[model samples]
Target: MPDWLSLYYEQPIELTHGEGRHVWDAEGNRYLDFFGGILTTMTAHALPEVTKAIGEQAGRILHTSTLYLSRPMVELAERIAGLSGIPDARVFFTTSGTEANDTALLLATQYRRSNQVLAMRNSYHGRSFSSVGITGNSAWSPTSLSPVQTLYVHGGVRGRGPYAHLGDAEYIAACVADLEDMLGQTAGGVAALIAEPVQGVGGFTMPPDGLYAAFREVLDRHGILWISDEVQTGWGRTGEHFWGWQAHAGNGPPDLLTFAKGIGNGMSVGGVVARAEVMNCLTAHSVSTFGGSPVTMTAALANLTHLLEHDLQGNARRVGGLLAERLRAVTAGLGLVREVRGRGLMIGVELVRPGTDEPSPEAAGLVLEAARERGLLIGRGGTGGVALRIAPPLSLTVAEAEEGAELLGQALHAAQDHMTGRRS
Candidate 1:
């Protein structure tokens, strides 16, 4: 593996197995999995329904190219199309989020006949060449060389920006004005605006509600497509809405919506849902050989069924609300804690230096290590990696949420103590 491929912790532990919201490491220590494998294990770990579906499908057939008519693929696509809310929706499967975003970009650029694109500042779409081109996070985008000309827009991160001091309504207006200005400055009709509904890698930061809807009006006038990258925030993770874009449903759905992570419940399943006209814009032949493998589709179908049947979205709303409240109460007096914000199950706790506004990645690292010590696994993000991301499975129980919150509270205090040199 490349040295650039990073791992968590001062000494990373190998997870051997997991069930529900807990995972056991190679050292035989069990930890409550708060991050959910970067929010990929959406429903749960070792979910029996998904596992059984995978086994049953594998017993029947494992591999088949897109040339063949796969029932599972078509069925899953149908389910997604109905759920996607895009009129005359078309679904295309991919093996990962990067490929999904890449496909969306391909469709948008081809349809608009322009390579210029709009992306959100402090956003992360994917890691592929095309996806990276529109990624606004400099830390993630390694090179300036990109296939498309990307013009980044603001309003992704609410608390830390030039317009941070403004209220929600004012903030939205400012971002909309900024976007209009950028669009006017652009040379030609831009292909699309790709954004993470809630920035995953940027410390789970998000704009105020309805920010995208405001931008949609401007894009509509220019015939620019809106691509909502819901890789991390899809499938009812946000709790309040089934899809993140639904929060901004003042306008309808986006032209393209890319989803991955959690749909397969650990299986590699990703896809793009777009309006038929935009999706069919590709005049050339295209197919994902391993994109919608029967086994993965089966797993996704079973996983999705379980999610809906069990009303995990409602669970996310109730339990995530409790968890966030608990965390806020615990971190309220802590000087190192800046803010705790998020919706549903996806929450971010920003850490700053003691008695200062400066970001403290060191404090975040310490908190991660401390959380591990207490048998809780979380995640880190943000431009400077100063925010702790907590996103457990949608099936996370209220008891589990309480347990994880207590453990995290202890971890936060421990991190603060370590940072202040009160603990040697």
Candidate 2:
């Protein structure tokens, strides 16, 4: 593996198998999986519906590319287009979120006839050359060179930025003003302003609701496209809305949107959705051979069906609320915990140096290690790796949420003691 390849835990355990919310390591120790393989396992591990779909599809045929008629692919696309809420929306499937965002950028740039893009500060899109260029996190984006003339904007991270101390209304005005100023500096019309509804890799950070709606007014005036990168916050994971863009309800929807992560329930499924005009901008033929493979499509169809049939979105709202309350209660008054924020199952617990707001990556690491030892698996995020990411599967039951919270509480206290030299 390359040195840059990221892995969790100082001593990563090899997961052998899993069922529902629990997984067993090579040593046969069971763990309650909170991160869901970086939020890819949407429904549950080894779900019978998804597994059966793959099995049944595999028996018939697998690799019929875009050259032929694909029922499963079309079906999945139709469902996504309808759910996306973009009028006359068109869908294009890819193998990952990176490719999905890349395709959205391609369409936006081509349709607008400009290579310039507007991205949020402290945001992460993906690792592809084009995606990396727009990513605002320096830790992830290794290159300064980019295909598009990318301009980083504010209003993504709320509490730590220049406008953090301002009241909500004042902060919104400041961010909107900053955005107007940034646009004035741009030489030509920007192709699009792409954003993650919740900056996932930037540590589940997000701005006040409707911040994007305010920016939408500016984009609309300049005829610049708004692209919501819902790769992490999509599929009702946020609970309040199916799509993250819906949080900014004043604006109808974005011109373009990208989705991946949980849609396939561990299957490699991703795609871009846009109004017909934007999606059809590509002149030449473009196809992804392995993108809409029957096997993957079947898995996605089944997984999506299960998600809706079970009303897992409601499950996310109810169980996630309980989990959030538990987390806030446990970490309250702790010197190392800065804030507890996030919606639904996508929660982030920001850690700071004891008695200070400065990010404490060391404390976060200790909490992660302690949690793992207690048979729990969580994730870490944020620019400085100071946020504990807690996103369990949407299908998580109330009992599992309670159990995970208790274990996490114990881990946090242990981490606090170790950090303060109470434990040697």
Candidate 3:
């Protein structure tokens, strides 16, 4: 490591190799990988097809501009459009979830012809300038809330889509009203409402049932598009959902659906599925080259084939439910746990102080470290960074998931013991 290079967070142990859910540290210690590359490695580590595809593709063509076009790229786009469960949708490839967010945001702006967006307070979209502006977080960089100021708090409306803009979901409406007021008095027009269908990085938060239905009605009335950021929740990772939006009640679909992670199965690929009407705004626009290489798209195509062939989406639901139930049962006695939330495998264990009611972030870190040392690897999340992110590969076995949960229980108890020893 360079001397001037700042450690982003905790120092990560060097792993020599990984296969399935197990990882071997440089020192030869084995760890069960509950993190699963932040929920990207859906097929698990060192997946056979992924390795073969990479080796074969790397040996072949690597890059070619979209202008020239490529078979694999076009084929993969067709696959995405077809599997995206959207009719007459178009696909635009990108390099990461951030760029996907950027693409969706751009499309939303064009769709509503407005300057505002609506997002939830606990939402986590991405870290780009515009995405961050709509991303509701205090520490999400200074640019997180800088784009529209008061107006950014509201949503856009150009055509019919999802919306209620009232009651509990009313904040989205308040945002809409704010945008309407701002547009009437100032700049005018609201662009879109972008959010994670299931807030993966934001503590695996899930909205109420039928929420999207009401939201859709509202957006339709306002003419603002619904952009679902499925970077972490897409594919079979969330079990029953092929698309994250389906988990919530909604009619029809999102104007733009963003994807990364599972679609690439850890490959550096991301993109957006846009409704033809919304995507039409880009026809006259010039391409600045965000498209993926032939090799990357080939890998994505292979991954998609694998996902459907194995029916991994259904597996995600079955195994994830089994594991979450086990963990929730074991953690039920803990005083430091606030709640265990989220659907499928994208679970979160929110931490709070036992008695004082303040979150015990240090305690959560201790548990995570203890779990790592005891042959399991888990990560943290949430606003205070105290969430135990227990998402594993969608392909993880029921036995493996149970084993991971058991180890996490042991680690939590061990952390509690350490605190007791210190207090005594």
CA lDDT scores, all candidates in order: 0.93, 0.92, 0.74
Off by over 4 Å in 2: 422-424
> Compared with the true structure, what per-residue lDDT tens digits does model 1 show for residues 1-424?
9999989988989999999899999999999999999999998899999998899999999999798999999999999999999999999999999999999999999999999999999888889998888888888999889999999999999998899999999999999999999988999899999988899999999999999999999999999999999999999999999999999999999999999989999999999999999999888887779999999999999999999999999999999999999999988899899999999999999999877899999899999999999999999999889999999999888899999989999998988887788633
Q: What RMSD, rounded to one decimal, does every model reach? A: 1.1, 1.1, 4.9
- TM-score-sorted candidate list, best first: 1, 2, 3
Residue 338 lDDT in candidate 2: 92
lDDT of 3 by residue, 326-372 (tens): 88887887777777777788888877766445767877888888888
TM-score of each predicted structure versus truth: 0.99, 0.98, 0.88
Estimate candidate 1's RMSD in Å: 1.1
lDDT of 1 at 178: 99
Q: After aligning candidate 1 to the native by TM-score, how far in Å is the CA of 50 from where it should be?
A: 0.7
All candidates in order of lDDT, best leading: 1, 2, 3
Compute the lDDT for candidate 2: 0.92
